[model samples]
Target: MATSIESHVVDITTCAICLEKLNIPKYLPCLHTFCESCLRTYITAIFEKEHKQSIECPVCRTTVTISKEVNTPDEWAKVLPLNFLIVGLLEKEKLRDHKTMHGEELKLFCADHHTPCCSMCVSIHHRRCAKVLSIEDAAMEYAKSDEVKYLKTHLANVDYDVKVIIKDRSSAKENIDKDYKRKQRDLEVIFSDLVAKINDLKVRREAELLKIYNEVKETIDTTLIFFQNKQKNIENEKQIIDAAVNMASNVQVMIEVEKLKKQVEEHKQVIQSKTKEIVNYELLLQDVENITKLAEQMEKACQISCKKPNTYIALSSVTVTPNVSEIFSCCRFGQHTCSWGVKGAKQDAICVSLSKEIELYGLLSYVCKDALATCDVTATVKDDTTDLVVVKDTIDSKVAENNTVKIMFPKPVKLLANKKYHVVVVMKGTSWCYAGGDGETVVDSNGVVFTFNNSPLSNNGTNTNAEQIPGFVFKISDEL
Candidate 1:
């Protein structure tokens, strides 16, 4: 008995709305596959009518929505064998039609030439053209050839090069990371050094400030104690005077009053001395305070944003110069001569007048051979001049005969404001024959030499003379 042949059941996955086998199926989180378009349209309908825009999966009730752009059939062809299915369907249809006409052979033809061509000729003549061919011919002649094998090998080489490039890029990234770490370490070292220097400077400046403060405080405290003691003594003496005034008629009171007066005088002297000491201490304290304040200001001025090692050292190296006044003066003395008397004794006498004037505050140091030297040196606000001082003396040395002697002064004194002073030297003597006749006796010249601080002055061969002396005029001010 010929039974009816049962057809093979094909399981088809499809979208419900389109009733077409799904070419590009998007699987939702709910585990349902639908055509990308059907999912999008279903979600749009839900959005328009319902307040809730989310759509539920068809198969499962889980909420899911389509992506904005649907994946096309071409994209789906990437992962699935959809193109192979189409080719297989077309092949089956051709075979069925060929079987119906039994007398004529079914000939495979190249679609491009529209004529029957052998499989080898089809592949060689129409290769890479957009033309269709019988499935049997395509499979037998083109797919089985060495050309296909070569293409596969080329693809493999291309993949290998891609992997090499990726490895090299990774190596480069690692090198960059190492270099960054090294630079970070160097910066950290520099930061640490800067911090250390800042701390050192803070400590040094703090010590200096404390030292100055302590010294000034000690002086002020001592002065306060001294003044307190003096005040107590003055009060006790005043009480004695008051008690004596009440007992005037008594003889003992009279004697006590006299003794009290003496005591008062002594107390006055003590008070004066204490007052002077206090004033002096006060002045010294003020000077110390000023210095301390200046140091504070300097610390502020020298503060810097960045810490550097040499900053404090350089600041401390600066030198300060004080204001100074200079003055000079000069004076001259007479000459001397030697003679022989009739008794074969040597006689020597000198007549000398020494005169010198110096600028105010000038200091002088002088030396002479005989007592017969006379000299006067004076200094004034406006000028430095010399006047004569009497001299009677004799110098015995022949080399010293009529030779000059000089008074030398180093580092000329600062001129006092609006003041004048004199430096005088006197000498008197006779020649070797003191009680005898006198011959020609020359007077030795006496002179004064002066120099200003940092000024040019020289001593010539003669002791009585110098090259130059500096002089100055000054006026005192209330501010000084």
Candidate 2:
């Protein structure tokens, strides 16, 4: 019986300091109970060595204050409050031991008090109370009661709730890690783009400076070579005059002197003309006054934005370009007699209606004649009544083949769902590209539908819709 009772409650009555059953259990402010003698020894050592009026709990390390009135260590330990629960448990243990030694069976139970009682306790304590039953009958009734069923059900619900909370927390942690990596990648891309632009600017400026310097240096070098040649000619003339005076006849010397005089006048005139052409070429660097201001602006470019829970930003998925071979295969817009200039004020355009919100990455246009000038393909949303542009993206033609050309926007354009937008490819001075449309409505591999307009749109006032539609397909990404 003692072993069975101890199995349920031995730790509760044990003292933390002595590691045994509590003796005169005293509790500190932190609710940790300890033996009185153990506390006295611990508190006395603290007061003597450290000369402090407070001690930390052995278990939880909470400070416990000693009252000023309690002068001695023994008094300090004695002044702590007693743990009534521990004392009651100890008393119950003593009672159980007495019952076992004397062989007194507590076979009766008082239902009103809800406790097992010996025969003597029933006659003395529960004599006036009714509703007393044998302990075995009471136990059997409790086992079949609704209270037991409710307890089991409640415990099962609590277990399920605990499991769900743990799983949710784990999932939240994983999402946090993924978001961290994605945001880090975004930050790197932004900085890398800035660095690339700065480096490109630096290279271009350096090349310009070097080109100017080389041109000026070459001009100066040529001028120096011309002066050296004139000096050599004069020296040769002087040597000829010296030889004529020393070895030639008087007539020959006079003729040599006249020729030398004429040559000297010609050389002087050439030198004067060359001096007028000599320029003071000094290289000047136009300083960037806004560089410091740009640096200051760049410092505030990226900001850390924290969003609330359940807020998410989606990323675009890579997708293949749509196939529009059927749309452009039937007829040609600019084939032989008619040509659409790339930079011309007149434009060839295709109007498309989108089914859902999409991010436009690029546009694909068919090319019949080779591109003469760089083309600007623009996508614009207009108000139906006013024809004012809402959103627009214009990108220069980057890659143009004889078959088809791809013009990509520097940044993706976000178009709303269920809206009609026009993509216009403009050209001017020389005509090169040919495209056809109005064949069929085609769906891309990414499930984006491209509904072709019945007629091609043009500012040139030409009605060529019945023959062909503008051949173009929008490059849509999955993310907004």
Candidate 3:
């Protein structure tokens, strides 16, 4: 009987509708108790399934009518009264659950303190809080929950984010490495060019100094030889006088004394004049020293460098050249004419001036007509003043296609900044393909014209024959 009474105590607080401890316990007309949420759900299900406006008790067959004022599903619970007995039992059980192995039970949760506290704690530390629950009730419902599956998912996301950050960092590092190497190469090239120019200047300066040195050395050696010969003649004449004084009569000595004296005087005057001529180069030597010192100071004061690569510049944008006629005669402008070997050889010359250094990366042009078979077409880049050829290329005219194409060099040319280069196109060895053009003409100091029986490849600088065909189009581009 005691055991049975204990079972009733445990079960009394549970609602038959929910099988859980009764929460917000409500009493029906038949004296059946239920949780408010469970009763609402049962009533809704019955109305939906049977079109009934009332619910029958699960334990008893008593039926209760739903009030007309119950507009929402939640309002249905309002018609039922609170089950005070069930509520009292729930409170009693909550206190029992809070009881720990120790005699004291933490029977209250203080909202203001955010903690579960015993009655003593509530009276002292959380006295101002209006409401507090027993620890077992408050902790079960209010504590932020932990679910293993959700925790694992969140941890996986954090790890994935870290990996993505690492990948981004690695890519950034690679880009930095590439940039570093590029800058290093640029520095090396710049210094190399500077060193080369310095060496060239040194060689030229040495040549000039050597010429002056040779002239000065020759003059000094010639003066020394002349003076030395005079000394030998004077010594020989002195010996002859000494011998005459010792052995010959006084008359012989006296006769030669005056004549020899006059001769010695003449030799002395000639030596004095020659000595004056050689000794008067002090001003000239001083000028040379001052010029050298000034040159040294100038070099030290300035950074010497050619123009750096800057804005992108190009050649003619027109891809095609204008022809004189259908058969290609000269219009208001001139046409590039190659009259085979019979007409002899003529060269087409063009000049480009650049303000900054540039790499001759590529060329684009159209070959309007190339019919000659054995003709060799050649091109050259040269300085206008010294005729120093910088680069030269040649192609077999027989194999050239008629469409526009890019002409590439095996190695690109590095053009110095602030200078002009003369470009010459030659048609040689029976080659008779013309680059025709006619609208405008480019006036260049380096442009010239020439006619010769030999191949145009043999020439470097422009001659009197240079002509600019207005409509001719050639394109140039830099690598960077």
Clashes of each: 42, 11, 12
lDDT of 2: 0.52
Which lDDT tens digits does candidate 1 get at residues 1-480?
Answer: 123211221223445567676645556565556666666566666666684535677766887533435343323223222223323323222223322122444244454543444445545675755665563554345434543334334323333322332333344334434533443343334234334454464455445434533443454355444434433433443444344334232322333333444544454454334323321111111122232235443334322121111100000111111122222222322222322112222221211112233322231222233345332322111223433222222223322222332222221233333233332322222322111122112222122322222111111111222211111222122112
Q: Top model by TM-score, which number? A: 2
- Candidate 1 ranges beyond 4 A from true positions: 1-12, 65-139, 158-480
Task: Write model 3 residue lDDT over 1-480, tens digit each, in one string.
Answer: 999986997686778977888888888898888889998898888878998888899779699888887875578886677766566455434433423323456566665554556778777777889768765555454323332223223333333332332343344344434543453343334334345554454445444434544454455456555555454445445555555445443333433343455555465455435433432111011122233335443233222221212222111111112111111111123344432231345665655555444445334332334444344345555665554433333343444544223444323466565566665555454333344333233322112211111123334323333222111112222323
Ranking by TM-score: 2, 1, 3
Worst 10 residues of 2 by lDDT: 310-319
Q: What is the Å distance of residue 103 in model 3 from its true position? A: 99
Per-model TM-score on C-alpha atoms: 0.23, 0.26, 0.23
Best by lDDT: 2
- Regions of candidate 2 where Cα sits further than 4 Å from its true position: 1-344, 367-398, 441-445, 454-457, 461-480
Q: Scored by CA lDDT, what does every candidate get?
A: 0.34, 0.52, 0.46
Worst 10 residues of 1 by lDDT: 308-317
TM-score winner, 2 or 3 = 2
Q: Alpha-carbon error at 95 in model 3, in Å? A: 99
